[model samples]
Target chain A: MDKFTVLSAVAAPLPEENIDTDKIIPARFLKTTKRTGLGVHAFDSMRYRADGSENPDFVLNQEPYRKAEILITYDNLGCGSSREHAPWALLDFGIRCVIAPSFADIFHNNCFKNGILPIVLPHDVCTQLMEDARMGGNARLTIDLPRQVVVRPDGTEVPFNVDPLRKKLLLEGLDDIGQTLQHEKEITTFEERRAQAQPWIPRIVLD
Target chain B: MAPRTLFDKIWDSHVVETLPDKTAILYIDRHLVHEVTSPQAFEGLRMSGRRLRHPDATIAVVDHNVPTSDRTQPIEEAESRNQIETLERNVKEFGVPYFPLLSARQGIVHVVGPEQGISLPGMTIVCGDSHTSTHGAMGALAFGIGTSEVEHVMATQTILQKPAKNMKVVVEGQVGPGVTAKDIMLAIIGHIGTAGGTGHVIEFAGSAIRELDMAGRMTICNMSIEAGARAGLVAPDETTFEYVRGRPFAPKGEAFDEAVAYWKTLAADEGAHYDRVVELRAEDITPVLTWGTSPETVIPVTGTVPDPASEADPGKRAQMQRMLDYMGLEAGQKIAGTPVDVVFIGSCTNSRIEDLRAAAAIAAGRKVAEGVRAMIVPGSGIVKAQAEEEGLDKVFLEAGFEWREAGCSMCLGMNPDRLTPGQRCASTSNRNFEGRQGPGGRTHLLSPAMAAAAAVTGCLTDVRELI
Candidate 1:
């Protein structure tokens, strides 16, 4: 994972609300163990027609939006499924920041873990961003995590707040597993005490 | 100190270490794994040269990818076969207790966990699948985790979690006959909207919730995720104890009694404070049907589709318009008698034996309407055999319903059983997302009895009418 400090990229506006994980990447595409090829199938049903031709009217299928790296959507984005494939697909599709009014908790957490910045702005601000995103390829939105601001193509900055820990992790490119391992000693002590209290639980050795 | 809610008690007890930022390394007592999410987590562990910290604490099962038809035949979908095969290989290599495809113990991870007694009162349980909240019916503090967090739990039997806010949904009054837990759940979600419980774990309390059987309780908790809640729970009581008494992993005799003594204290204290509270009258609950994409886009079977023109918020009105357009339903149209192309009566939600019996009772002596494709996939191999022992399968098969093997079939359509494009289905599954069953498929989430009623009528029909 690369450290996510700042990046400037074209913004694509998907103005719909409740764009669920199933819509982000349908369940059928989740069959693969590997994560790389999912970007092509990201919105499988909506992006492609029954005959496998691109749905020209869909947002991502349009000319400048095909190269979008920031997605500005509406309320409750990533509202269903715990599949990390949702973010994998978004990252694979070159979407680094997803600005929405709100996000489902699990999907939001998964995004941070996978190096995607899920920005939760106010409804009005999200609307503003969505409108700005409509500028297509010319709108190069810059997301600066360290500065906590999203710079629009016109040079105006919209400030955002992120959990200090999450921002630190994102900037350092650290996943939760790496941070959790730092508490190994405390965890081992807790387990030892727990095993004493609950004798029914079996112990396993790493050989 | 403030009076602690049941959620606070369980969560606080599980905390191994709480960091300055409020993230706690919560010890997981039981970790449930399935085909779709665990493969990559296992791959992560292998790549990092770390072994499972506590293999015994974890249970693996094949459910999501397995075919519900033709058990003996090789899975035709290559990718689906590889997913299941990868799980088998990973579980074998990791030495975790596993329930392979068609094995008696194999089933939906959510169902098998509680049935096998791996889920118990006061335990912290998690799975890579969101519906892990199903185990919370056992009075456990359970929620779903992503693949990366799954690997965290696999390696340490712990995952870092921030505590969730507590919301108490207290239901009073007696539920009417033919109304089940599913109806109550749908009524709740319909009232609260899809994102109502986003940051909270809901405790379903009061006389109405306590009255439901274990299976009914499970059904309610299973869909908590659909309401955007982390989990839902009912306090452990006699019904819970009786259900767990002699299961494969339940404690025996003296141990059981001691466990029961502790479990009694797992309920919320009289003066416990909840961050949020909602009250409902059980008698008000009716057979619910989702007319549109989201679970929150639900209405009573007797009610009409919501008119977007009636919505005050412009954004919400547009959202409603999109939903109505996609569903091919007119505003103000009645939900009942809306034609259904298919009916699916199985999933982690409403796939227990009790759920089957309810649908079977409805299906008995009635034939599915002409042109309606109806299927009943049991939740697990054990459930399938149990349904057959009671001749439930025969009743369904005779009623023109396809009695398939145990798996998540047509619920999100990962398998061969699916609704074609533009087809509409009345399903007993949790989600009603657009294209959830298949590309351009429409789903109406309802109870098992309602689904059975839809099958017989070839439309979304109220179970009360038939009963």
Candidate 2:
């Protein structure tokens, strides 16, 4: 993945609340061991017509959103089940930033780990963004991860704040497991303490 | 300085030791395991050749892949049968207590724990599932852990942790008729915006909370994860003690009084402060329905699907369009009369006896929709047996709905009973995410009675009419 100071691309709007993880990436896709190649299956039910074609009315199938990287949604986005696959699928589908009135807990953490910025704006502000995205394909929005700014096509800039630790990890592409492992030296020292304190623990080599 | 709250007491007691780094080594009092998530953790333990630290404190059940409607026959699916078989083998080998699918104790882990009195106040619990917070209603400090974390607890009886910010979500006024705990939670989700409670432990209080039944309080605390809170709790009181008094694992006789006396000391001080406090008016809530591919995309059934275009936040608008598009819904469309094919009324969230009664009450004289498949799965084998003894099973069966055994059926598509592609379902199970039930399946989340109502009507109708 390339690091870019994201400029005005496109912002598509979907105002329904409680968009859960299953809808973001359904369960069947979950059976696969590999997390890659989930983009095609993302929102398969709604994105495709019953006849197995793209739903023209879908925001993704519409104009400027064809190249959209930023998405705006309604309240409680990513509500319901906690499936990390939701963020993985969204990231694979090219969604770099999601601005919502709110996000489900597990999904919010998943988003940050997968390098998707979930910006929570107030409900009134969310309503305004939805209108801008509804203008169709030409509606471009800029998401500058470096500056934590979500800029609108109208030259308006909205700055969002994330936990500093998480921001650094995401910028450096360090997931939770990755973050924990990055301190291999410290983890090893802790393991030594564990071996000394709870000697019953079966010794295993990390390397 | 002010005195500690119940949340602080529970959290402080669980903190075993602070590491050189700031994180705490939190000891787990009870560890709950199920078929799907447990397999890997057990495998990790086997690979490391570590005996479970305290087998007595660990409990297991076969739920996710267990069929609720027909346990009389072998699971036809090779994979499902294998998973359950593996769990049975693993439990036997490890000498761990397990609630097998056909056992009288079997059901969803969350519901089973509380009903068995396994979830107690002032205890720290961990499950390999997110809804573990469901036990918080009993005033326990509980949360879900991942596969590896599950193994860590199994080996050492503790998990690494960081302290959470405190939040108090207080609900006032009396909840009106047709407004159950489910409605209060949905309304709160709407108010707090899902992630509003992230990194926080939410204490649900005030008059309305005090009035809720045990099952209702469990339902509210169960979805705390949905609000991004690490846990949700209600201060233990008479209602809490009454529910815990005579359960199989709860204290009895002399022990009971001693437990209650100790429990009272854990209550929050009158002036204990919180990092955040969000208030909700109970009277404002009604039976709610979710229209989007998410949980927070909920509105009253009578309300129209949202028009995201009118939202002021550009970031939120784009996300809203995706939700509406993925849900195959248009802005401002009525949620009612949206036809559904499957109606599932069971999960860790709402598969308890109270939930079953609510669904059965709505189905008493109603016939299910022509093509909709409706299932009422109790939360556990005990619940199933009790319901049958009380004839609640017959009530649903006579109503043209299938009365199934207890398990985490249709909550997630880990089992054979799942929604087919593009099938719209009215599910009482939490999570309305697309394909959550199966590939390309659409889920509309609702309460047990609401799901039953949808089954009867084959559309998204409010349950108030029948209830």
What is the DockQ for all candidates, taken in turn? 0.56, 0.14
- Give the residue spans of candidate 1 off by over 4 A: A201-207
Q: A30-149 in candidate 2: lDDT tens per residue? A: 543334577787776668877889999888777777667877887667755555567667767878888987776656765765677788888788878878777776667777777988
- Report the number of the highest-TM-score candidate: 1
Chain B TM, every candidate: 0.99, 0.97
lDDT of 2 at B351: 84
Clashing pairs in 1: none
Model 1 per-residue lDDT tens digits across residues A133-156: 887677788999999999987899
Model 2 spans > 4 angstroms off: A1-26, A29-207
Two-chain complex of model 2, DockQ on C-alpha atoms against the true structure: 0.14
Per-residue accuracy of model 2 over B28-65 as CA lDDT, tens digit each: 77888877656756775677677776667778888877
The top-ranked prediction according to DockQ is: 1
lDDT, model 1, position B251: 76
Q: What is the CAPRI rating of model 1's predicted complex?
A: medium
